[model samples]
Target: MMRCGSVIKVKPGMLDEYVKLHSSVWPDVLKMIKECNIKNYSIYYKDGYLFSYFEYVGIDYEGDMKRMADDPTTQKWWDVTKPCHIPLETRKKGEWWAEMEEVFHLD
Candidate 1:
């Protein structure tokens, strides 16, 4: 399995709504995530910053990500959630969440 982490900022005053939306994530979107070989996904927020972590079990990470991006339900889910996000200006092209490098891991 491969571990991944990313971060993004939430628009001002949008934290409550964003948290509410995630409290009960759409079923289809969850299914798509699992189908893409992602596991142990979690999101945390602090000072407007949203941090995400997950494990990728698939052999083809890029392909799995592409498949997830192509899903209609996933696209619709993003439509609802994206407005609440303020992506980091420093993020690389085609990146909405700024990917973070792992500096240390105990497991």
Candidate 2:
């Protein structure tokens, strides 16, 4: 399994809405996530930033991500949630959340 972490800023006045939306993510979206081999996904908030973590168990991470992005339900979910995010200026091209480097890990 590969662990991933990412970060993005929540737009001002949008954190609550973002949290509420995530409180009950769409079933189809969740199913797609699982089908794409993403597990233990979690998002956390602190100050104005949102941190995300997940484990990828699939062999082809890029292909799985592409599959997830191509899903209609996931597209709709992104439509609803994208407005609440302020993507980091430092994020790579085509990245909505800035990928983080893992400096330490145990077990």
lDDT of 1 by residue, 30-51 (tens): 9999999999999999988999
Cα displacement (Å) at residue 44, model 1: 0.6
Candidate 1: misplaced stretches above 4 Å?
A: none
Model 2: runs farther than 4 Å from truth? none
State each model's CA lDDT, in order.
Answer: 0.97, 0.98
Query: How large an RMSD does model 1 have?
Result: 0.5
Clashing pairs in 1: none
Report clash pairs, candidate 2: none
TM-score of 2: 0.98
Residue-level lDDT tens digits of model 2 in 21-90:
9999999999999999999999999999999999999999999999999999999999999999999999
